[model samples]
Target: LEWAGDEFPWVLEHHSNLEPETQTWHSKLVTENWDSPIIFTSMVQFLEVLFGGGSRGARRMHNIANSVLIFDEIQSLPVNCVHLFCNAIQFFVDHARSTTLLCTATQPLLDNLKFPDKGQLTLPDDRELVGNMTEVFEQFKRVEIKNLVRPKGWSEQKLIELMITQLKEKGNCLVIVNTKKWAKKLYDRCINSVDADSLFHLSTSLCPVHRKEVFNTVRQRLDDELPVLCISTQLIEAGVDVDFNSVIRFLAGLDSIAQAAGRCNRNGNLDMAQVYVVNPQDEAIDMLPDIKEGREKALRIFSEKDETELLDPEVMSLYFSYYFYERANLMSYPLTEKQAGRKDSLLSLLSDNHLNIGIEKNAIKLQQSFKTAGKAFKAIDSPTQAVIVPYGDKGKEIIAGLCADFEPAKAFKLLKEAQKYSVNVFPNVWRKLIDAEAVKPVQKGEGIYFLEERFYSENFGLSTEVVSKMDTKIS
Candidate 1:
């Protein structure tokens, strides 16, 4: 739910009934509404409320009052504030306010922090949590990790050639890299090299609505066993669910490697689906702040201890333990600065489930909270224009006749193979389109795309420059 909140504006606006200003505010309301059995929110949203900055951040501070809050990608939290984040969770759990579960293949040594001189939540023994986590992973054999750490040899072309050969028979493949530019470059190369019916591209470059359309289409194609190929960044690595029969990852950190593996044969249907961990030559890590830090820590782990045992769960724990400790000092606990003075905020939030009951109670408290409506996002608005690219002479005529009232459903049907058009959206138009299934989400690697009716117009949002008219029309 919180994933959609963080990523999809439509989900956040409608489901949470939040205006633009209140989007981040709704993460707190997840537990207040308490409708679902599970909620997947980011580390920032979870920890921000505990630290308490403003009214919106404070809303969820009380929502997690009495429930299980699982922090996914716990290692991704900024380094200097690990003590502050962990201490907050400790307080909630220690006081019986909530059951806290930390989920990550790599566990940071959380005991390194010194909280207030008094009133800290005592944690469960680290040994037991680590043991249970390992056991759970072993039981779930959907993901199999293969470690291939070679210092040299292998160009991007060679990797793409190998993947095209493999994907021809496998039907679906995912290639994950470290950056958007590289993902785009690899996607273009794969599209040019591979003999596939459909090629998809995904990255964080596409807004959330655009990304969702691409993801949904790729997922449907995979389920139908259709020929599809994608290249993307690590955005799809963690919680995004479409599994490919094969996955190729450019190596960096052990945790990321594990996440890349999770996207392969995730249902455990194939007896032996392959996950290749290769080192990309000419790969730039300077743009990747977390990856750079994680790689440095992983190198230290490999050199001083456990060379053969690298990426092993135990080895990963130590790797993150060192990584977070160093990272925390770099940022100097920017989000956790309030930890010193606001001892009572945590205490008051944890004080009572008496506030948990009654819709009236929640309604009254929410009313008392500040209200902030959202600004209109230009990417999403009504009556937004789309482009019709005529790849050939015939395609040009088909697009030239387009009018505002022309049938969108039929116009989309004609542009299937021609130079494709870019569909633009008005505020909330995408939410309507998605609900009506007028537009479908297609996922390639980590980039999302959609196919919708082609409209002819010179004006558009940021998508205008991307639209090109093709010389030929299917008609």
Candidate 2:
């Protein structure tokens, strides 16, 4: 506050492929230098800066010192990077003189973070800002979660009936499923049954701008006490402001369940809200190992604890303890593909370079592979590609601009705007689109791909099914 003399957050940052203007702005305000009092960044950017490389950390070292680092929804941090992340934070506090604040309703067992050399990270005993967290969580409770996981899961028809009933009773309802395919299926099944105006869908398949439009419509419907139903993936689980009187969440970790509940009674307009955890028949989560493992862990807690104690801060701590303990072997990002079965991780490469057992190096610094470590680690740890979709007028306009004669300044600005209209797809889905000639590069070898307008849907989003020239295919 004292340094910038600005009351608002001017440095909104996510360090990745950026426009030239924004890049200049980042340096102009020393945002990369971490001089701003308040700046919002993605987990990817944060992890990249922390573990990406030595040069990045070195550049921001003095600036980040004494700054308060707040990690919202800390539970969403990747399990593979837990120990590495914990050690990095421990180093920041002990040696770099920075304060780290982990904020989440579902508090993880990060306090028990263990390092190999250092037995345990000694977190601060007291947080002056947040005293008596248990009472705080209890006092702030707004939703009551009910478990409805049955031996035979709810059928598609039964799930729709429940959603309709909830919408009629609660005025607005939100159903969050495990995957996009399921979300699309639910949206399609209810399209003819429910009024078009009252039904909505939200997922990463829709561009950010399209999703924002849906968010606005959903928020307005909730505010007006209208009977609205939304089918969505886990995209609305956190960082979304819309509130629903009732919500249906597919079973997952307690942390994820808590995040799902956050979307209900967000501002506490209702006296109390209901969150139903359901298991759907034929629900596919095999590809989503995180959600699959999380559901298994949550089931264990359900057997051991009462429903009322499920959302308790202590219970959350317990869930994370079980979660971390089970995945202790994977806390370090293991080098899998080429170096599998060697017990090598990015942490080892960054730390002691146990790979170099008896070798001695001079001033060349071959002991650590900072570049290799950065290259090996991905924040989400998924191989995904971005495709610019033509969702609406803005999306079309941006695409047109990018397709025009590639003027340097104009193209840079248009490329920045493309981010709002882009959708990320997995490699297989991308290949499907490419094979169908549904997407083409914005430039020859720039790696930026644009989706055909025919492939994008007004009701859902990107369709990955095989398509004939005359028809659109969605599966």
Best-matching candidate per lDDT: 2
Per-candidate TM-scores read: 0.58, 0.85
lDDT of 1 at 201: 67
Global Cα RMSD, each model: 12.6, 5.2
lDDT of 2 by residue, 255-341 (tens): 999999999998988888889999999987787777888898999999999988888888888888888788777778878646433
lDDT of each: 0.53, 0.75
Backbone clashes under 3 angstroms, per model: 36, 0
After superposition, candidate 2 runs with Cα above 4 Å error:
1-9, 12-39, 49-68, 92-99, 114-122, 357-366, 465-475
In terms of lDDT, model 1 sits at 0.53
TM-score attained by model 2: 0.85
